[model samples]
Target: MNKTDRLLAIVLELQRKEVVRAEDLATRFETSVRTIYRDIQALSEAGVPIIGAPGTGYSLMEGYFLPPISFTVQEAVSLLMGTDFIEQRFDDDYRVRAQAARGKIEVILPESVRNETSRVRKAIRLLISDKQVTPSKEKEYLEKIRRAILDERKISFHYVKKLADFDGNRHSVRTVSPYGLVLVQGSWMLVARCELRQDIRHFRLSRMTEFIALEERFERPAHFNLREYTPSDDRHLRVRLRFNQDIADKVKESNNHYIEDMEEHQDGLHVVLRVRQLDELLRWVLGWGADVIVLEPESFRNRIREEAQKMLKRY
Candidate 1:
């Protein structure tokens, strides 16, 4: 193991047991007694609660504690990588808070540990694009929503819904009991209890304008399950498509829903998917452009052809 790993292991070992002999640690870490002594001194200088006596080895000071800094190596790497990714993708105050939290972790880390962390952080990256115009009001609303969610308090928010086919016709001014927030398909959604519908609903956060936390508190339902709220009605008829080699590779990389089978074709590729709804599936299939061809379900093919004809006539 490297120096940082050895040091982390030493601290964890000492925390688990009341005392660990220097000779035992040296043997476990495959180092000499002198090296172990130096490591202990390093830990002490780093403000670790390490106490020792001559020949009695070392022990963590009783009741002297460090703030909980527990994380698996993979978990730590993921957090560091995710924070860096968000820092570039989001241009909001939340992104600044995330970066600050990452900085705090690095500041408290031992020099050796910090160096290892930096190496990992430098290796991961995310693609950047045009800057998104994040609304300042929405950012403030998110801050309040986050605090209410953490504290398990009721929050009242005015939600607005824009009509799809009608211009200047929209629905606004509704209140909800906020449950949780999630990011799905590159969009932020607030899952909550709709007062009018009396059912759980997911509201896109960007669409919500005004929000307020209520003075009343509500207990989270004991049977509330977040995973159960996602859209998973998969009983609709199936559809098949054939895509070119390049498009097939992209689909494989995404690893998303409704991929039943794939087979190589002389010209391109063949793929099948079982979809529950034709409208949503049509949108997704058309998104692939000419790279994909409809192969089955004549009803869906007819719908696509009709839509294409309508668009051509409009043009």
Candidate 2:
């Protein structure tokens, strides 16, 4: 791109990140470090609140805010759809705020843009509102946990594991330094440094029976990065399975992380998977019902048999 565009891009990049190295900027812009430096200097001269520190990288001046930027019809529609999807997914306070924000954006849009947005919205619809699947208390508890995370405070919660204890409950109290919240496979998980585990632990939001934000504050490690955190690094469980012809195409379409390989056959399709846990795979196989069958891993077959027996007993 041209010099003016590069300078604006640099400003936006710095705004998004806490620190950005000159070398990284050079690589991103496909230019020399000298050129990146010159661009930074140009932005600084133009009264952009850019901060540069030795050894560390560049940042926007703390507390400096960017002026509102205009969005095209498509961009506005996408943003509105995003807000709508979030509303459909959760019944949190975020929904109200997002709706308010969308209204404000709609009110401020140019007449033509507003007309386009109205037309565009009429063509798109998001009907899925499955808030009942999530606990009503979850949104309130989510707010409490979010506040704790932002303030670098600890959180205390009573969690009930899916697998139960003698009394059919895997309930326990835990204290953790709030680190990150991750959404995976329709579940909200809190990844934290657990005092209970004496290590990083993942807690499902649904399992948390009670939660409290603690007054005790803690220092977040300078090197701590939520983006690098994976809830489970163990992908050791390997198994082979087969799907009947009825679901051969469906199984292929619902591409899962565990899928390692596949072989097509006249009657069915054989597949291999590398997964973290057997129960995780078992639940997925169960979802497919008669359309799927475990081809290998005798242990998996046994578990399926046991679960099937239990399910039949219930019926």
Candidate 3:
């Protein structure tokens, strides 16, 4: 084992009992007694309480304890909840790493702390929206995408897009130079350069049926900024809407980037948003049901009206 691992093992061994002789440690580690002495001295220098006597050998000082690497009940609950949330939402090595991290934290914690963590977690559970359904293959696709992005390699993937009125359709395989994966609204998205489109496009991970990493790699542009890329012509689109007071109060709870202004009115509230896409704005407005109304931009208002009419006909 490496020096750090050996040192940690020694500490854990000492915690179980007191006074471990240098000879025993050396024998266990297959190292010389001199090396064991050196390791102990190093630990002591690093503020470990290694007390030694001429004959009694080495021991951690009585009542000398390592700083509690403990988390508060709330902190533990948050960590567990966040880890579980990510596991459902994203696919990457980070998900497995998070599980391992949680295991390690729980293993190292004292019994009382573990019990408290468990109690808090059981008492307060995460509540995700029912509409948020993560695909089973999402993690696998994400892993391949992340590998390609990190290695600056091109990737080929078969994508399926669902249409509003038609059956889901699949496209013939295409290659792209993947730039990055974005997590937006609890869904994973990949932003990449589509060879066919000759431009960057966002692909929802759930719709990516298959992904294959290519041997070919490319250098990302030095000036490429993912944050600067937006679907709208102006990168930012201002919108105005009217909502009932009840819905207005609910909107106030959200901190989405698009929301810019909110004012109370006799009937409800007027909301102004600086958004990136009309589709996104429409989705938010529709989510509030009939409690919201589009006030400006005849084009968007007409679009919403048409979509509502379509939904009405369906019903």
Candidate 4:
């Protein structure tokens, strides 16, 4: 970035936080400490009230504030689209707040920029089908869960597992310390420390019933960071399958998430899927009928064979 842009960004960064270290600013701007020092010197010379301590970091002087910055047409459109998405996906409170925020943004923009942003937004629309929109019940649950997480409280609910046992037992009661919520593939999932399992678990809001936010408070772990957390891979099972070459394009178009890799082979298309259990891919493989063949894991092959045998008997 040019010196002018970098200077502006550094000031903005300082405005964002109470104090920022020179090393942090250097890393953020992809420059050296010397460059950052020079940039800070330039800002100070230009009459930006910057305070720097020897051991501590740099900060803007008390009560110092920058003038309102203007947004580009693209930036305005992006903000408008974000508000639209929140209005569609979030709860009623956020929907109203988003609408109000949109109004504020619209009022602040220049007339030409507003007109251009409106034209751009009209051409590019964010549309969600009725099925993709968050249901009313789920939105209500989201608000409750959000409050619980913020308040550091416990919540209890009846959860229905996606997979059922042989005896058709899939319901379980859970009490969890609410940590954070994640939106995955049009579904709201809660990542919490489950008291029943004594470990962190992900629960889909759609599968939860009898939800209640308990008054009992719990301490969330200080080290737990939702943005950096990744689910363990030790439980993943690798299942390899071969598909008829004729349907290779169709398989690719399906865009299944668990599919880790695919390779073209002389015999057919070699597809490898990583799932938590073999049954996850069983129904999908069976959907292709004779066109797909399970190529590995004797247990999975045997299960497929048994299922095919049952199907034949039924026929």
Candidate 5:
């Protein structure tokens, strides 16, 4: 980056953090320590309130901040689009905040840039299907869970699993320490320490009902991080399938998440997928009809045979 841009970025970085060491700044900007020293000197000469010490890092003076900066048309659009997404996907509180933020941004933009942003935004749309949109109850659950996580409290809810137990009971009550919330494929999932299971587990928000935040608080693990957590892989089953050549391209376009490996053959494509249960892939495989073949796991073949025979009887 140019020196002028780098200077501005350094100031912004200072505003973002309480302190930044010279070495850290050098690594972030991919420049030499000598260059950073020179840049710091230049910023100091330019009347910026930068304080540096031998061991301590650099920091700006208290209450010092950059004046309002101009945003390019593209940058304005990106911010506006972010607000739009937040409005559509977040809770009512955030939706109101996003609308206010959008108005503030639009009011400050240059008229020409604002007009161009509006024109460009008309061509780009964020389409959310009904199934993907956050439901009313889910939004309430999200807000409560968010508060619970922030307060380091436990939450209780009744969850319905995808399958029933031997007694045909699918509903169960759970009390968990809220860890974090994750959005996967437009659905909200809660990652938490399940007290009943005595382990961390993921629960879909949609399947949760009668939710309440408990008054009791719990201490979260210092080393636990939701971003780096990976579930155990022992339960996952590997199933291989062959797709007919004609629909191979379409299969690639589907971008199914569980697909681990794929290779092209003259007759078709060999695709291997990992899923928690064989039933998880049953409907997806059936969607391809005769064009897709289950290439491995004779049990899956028998399962398919039984399903196909059931379909034949119905026909």
Candidate 6:
């Protein structure tokens, strides 16, 4: 079902049932609990009169009901189009659920409105990503961490660091009190108080394995705010790339965030980027294969070559 239809159905479902657990809603709708979480949030924002009990479920306020309501064709089209962002930004499971929600919206609309929505959908083309990053292998781990955060619980996990120091150690176990999840670039990082280090640290979810929630719960800091904890800033590495016409557009496509400047040159498109890590830049350059060349910062090119040789040796 489409998001709009699911939203409407959710209202009806709540009216019929006194209280419903998020897990039950996820099962009934064939969606992730997170998706149901967001849906409940959206419903509350729209003044659906939803009240929640910590462990039990969500229920409608005693004296509330949805008034008879319907949307115009234009309204439905606008709402459906907004789901594109949800599908683009979320994981595969959420995307599939969003698509199903769209189908539901279509099913409920009158024939004339449905036909219009379909026409609008077909005529308006949208492109999110040229390549979808493989769905994270750490999906289950992410859920565990999220549950811990919500429950004010401590979590223990085995983490593999991406960069090994001179000690040549890559693995360690950590016990942390999770703060919140943040999306850094395309990576999901957990901001937490590291019991091992005795400080707050950011751990990439992708690098985490063997996650477990401990029975011990930690008191959340009174002033802690996830948005304040994980912030985007302008300070970054300055680097440039020379892209051939064959993949100049692809280079532009990859980074809309830190792109400092783009110039059309006789050779191709020249891209200037302000970035955080050279490692990430090197990987992006490799993705373009022969079509892109590093223009300066000899250090980055050297690292890329060293990594390429390492790849060759491993193969």
Cα lDDT of model 3 by residue, 1-315, tens digit? 999889987887777777788888889899999999999999999999888889778889888766565676777778788888776666657778878878877887778878999987888767777667666687788888888888999998887654321243346566899988888877888988889778887888888766788899988988887888675345467789888887676888876657788889898988898755576677767778898889888889998999899889999
Q: Highest lDDT, which number?
A: 4
TM-scores, each model vs. reference = 0.61, 0.80, 0.59, 0.92, 0.90, 0.57
**For model 6, how big is the CA root-mean-square deviation?**
11.3
| lDDT at 244, model 3 | 85
- Candidate 4 deviant stretches above 4 angstroms: 164-169
CA deviation > 4 Å runs, candidate 6:
1-68, 74-137, 165-168, 182-188, 197-200, 227-236, 256-260, 275-277, 286-290, 301-315
In the range 236-267, model 6's lDDT, one tens digit per residue, is 78888888987777767776566789999898
The 0-to-1 C-alpha lDDT of every candidate, in the order given, reads: 0.75, 0.84, 0.80, 0.93, 0.93, 0.81
lDDT of 4 by residue, 283-306 (tens): 998999999999898899999999
Write the number of the candidate with greater lDDT, choosing between 2 and 4. 4
Clashing pairs in 3: 91-139
- Model 3 lowest lDDT segment of ten: 161-170
Candidate 5 residues lying further than 4 Å off, grouped into runs, are 163-170, 227-236
User: Worst ten-residue run, lDDT, model 4?
Assistant: 231-240
Candidates ranked by lDDT: 4, 5, 2, 6, 3, 1
Candidate 5 per-residue lDDT over residues 223-253, each given as its tens digit: 9988898878754688999999999889999
> 173, model 2: CA deviation in Å?
2.0
